[model samples]
Target: MIEARQLTKRYGDKVAVDGVDFTVRPGAVTGFLGPNGAGKSTTMRMIIGLDAPTAGTVTVNGRRYAQHSAPLREVGALLEARSIHPGRSAFDHLMALAYTHGISRARVSEVIEMTGLQSVARKRAGAFSLGMGQRLGIAAAVLGDPQTVMLDEPVNGLDPEGVLWIRNLLTGLAAEGRTVFVSSHLMSEMALVADHLIIVGRGRVLADTTVRDLVLQAGGDTVVVATDDPAELRRVLVGPGVEITGHPGSEQLTVTGLPAREIGRKAAEHGLVLFELTAKTVSLEEAFMELTKESVEYHAASTTGRAA
Candidate 1:
């Protein structure tokens, strides 16, 4: 488990991370999401003790990262894939890390094979592709076999197969009762992988909830109905706190805050047939955009002085 309580950070006059509180439980994948310059990286850095928080604190399991007796064994993080020395071979790099912890070469080999880096373990880090570098970083993170794993943008540039591999790897790690916390700007990938989400914006925590709850909060389970007898439907739907709007051209009426079953029953009672009555679900990307639209800091004003 990971707990960030009112974690705050500032650089001169600019505040990178405001007072933000969040919790990441074990046995599930928690996604940390935000736009560019949204302080997500800063927060993650603070969690791993890479950056000092100006106020508050972050803890893994029961203690702060620096307070842990064996930090590597408690938490493993892949913050940036390019943190490795460019000239060092992948195998040599892992060996160096193992030497610090008195870990065996067999353990190093296990991580290399686990991350599928066996083929290029002897290759220099500088010559590896972005995808390969990412895999190597993940290999190093998991080398200690930590109970909590945190990765920032784990799949920045990778082939489809590589992406799929990482997805399964993280799922497997979480299934093993390890806490997996990932941060990414990829909404679609997060939707497919994360069981819970922590949405941040402008150096503050905007939302910390399950993926299901976030989607439900977007107020999306509305059914769209199209019919030739929109007037009759409108008249029947009028009053009683029901909203009916014209659906651009045709005699279609869009009813809001109504269930599909009730709409069907009411239509039948009114002797009206619905040409199209289907429930429209909002995608994760769409829901994210709608929820974060007002929180976006930078925007280009259109000709009407509104955001473009």
Candidate 2:
């Protein structure tokens, strides 16, 4: 397990990471997410002892990373794929890492095959494609057979097949009772892969909970009813328990706290004819966008921005 207690970091006048507390448990895929410049990389660097925190603390398996006797065996991370030596062959790179830990050549081969890099094992890392580089990075992270793995943007340059491979790989690692903490900006991918999520924005945690809980908390199962008489529908839906909102200029009512069937039955009992009555559960991407919009640092052209 990885735990952070009020973890904070600052560089000069700018605070890269604020006091944040979260945990990544074993046997689950926990997603770490944030917008650009939201301090995800900084936090990962601090966890791995690459960067020092100005305040608070973080520990891996109950000890600081530096305090661990066999840190590589306890935690493995792939922070950046390009951090490897470009001129070295993939096999040579893993061999060097194995040498430092007194690991066997057989183990290096095992990881090479496991990451699907056998064909390119002898190729220089500089000549490998981005997807191959990412695979090589994963091989390095798993080379120690660590109990905890942290991968930042593991699927950045992957194709569809490569993406599926990584999703299965991370899930398999977690299934083996290993802690898998992955960070990605793709909400759809995270939604499909992560069992739990730690959403950070502006250097602080906005949420730390299961995907289901986050979606529920962001509101779900909204019933949209299109009717010519929206005012009557509003009057019927208006009460202490139900929420009714006018949907733009259309003669539609967005109802919450009521199931679609219940709304349909209510409308039918009231002798109301509806053009459309649809139950809409908010998608993870939509929920994530709603949660992180205010936290986003970079806003591109409004005219070109993709609609949610």
Candidate 3:
């Protein structure tokens, strides 16, 4: 398991990571998510001892990452996929890492095959493509058979097949009771694979909850109403704690602060002709956008042409 308490990091006068706290338990996959410049990478770096925390503590399997006698055996991480020496072959690189930790040549071969790098095992590391580099990084990560696995953007350069493979690999690791923590900007993939989430915004913990709960919480009151007469329906539904949105002449209305059944009842009582009424369940992407809208570091301007 991975745990952090009041973990903080600062660079000069800027705070990179705030007093963050979250736990990644074994037998589950936890996704780390945030917008650009939200301190996600910085937080991950501190977890693996890449950077020192200004305050608080973080532990991997009950101890700091550097304190472990065989760090690889305790935690396997793919922080940077391209952090290998250019002069070394894939096999040579794995062998070097194995030698330091007393890992065997057989294990090295096994990982090479596991990551589907057998054909290019003897190829120079610098010549490999981004997808191949990702595979090599993963092979090195699991080479020690560690109890915890952490990866940052493992699918950055992967194709469709590779992305699918990673999804299965993450779930498989967690199935074996390993603590699997991954950081990704892909919300759709995270929604499918992650059992829980640790979301950050501007270096602070914005949410720490399960996938289902987050979506439900964000979508609880949202309802879609289709009616023949939207104007009259809107007038009837307008009240305290209610929000309605739609084009003036549109037949559909997006309503919040009211339940679907309540709207149906009110419509029926008013004898309004209704076409459809749906309690909209917000998707993972929608929930994420709503939660992080205010925390987004950059905003793109409208593409609509302005008057010259």
The residue-by-residue lDDT of candidate 3 on 1-308, one tens digit each, is 99999999999999989999999999999999999999999988998899999999999999999999999999999999999998899999999999989999999999999888999999999999999999999999999999999999999899999999999999999999999999999999999999999999999999999988898779767899999999999999999989999997789999988889999999999999889899987889999999999989989988788875
lDDT of 3 at 46: 91
Which number leads on lDDT? 3
- The residue pairs in collision within model 2 are none
TM-score of each: 0.86, 0.87, 0.84
Runs in model 1 lying further than 4 Å from the true structure:
228-272, 300-308
State the displacement of the C-alpha of residue 67, model 2, in Å, after optimal TM-score superposition.
1.2
Q: Write the per-residue lDDT of candidate 1 for residues 73-172, one digit (tens) a residue.
A: 8888999999999999999999999888777899999999988899999999999999999999999899889999999999988789988998998899
- Clash count per candidate: 0, 0, 0
Span of 10 residues, lowest total lDDT, candidate 2:
299-308
Q: After superposition, how far is residue 299 of candidate 3 from its true place, in Å?
A: 2.5
- Each prediction's whole-model lDDT (CA): 0.88, 0.91, 0.94
TM-score of 3: 0.84
Ranking under TM-score, best-scoring first? 2, 1, 3
Off by over 4 Å in 3: 225-274, 279-281
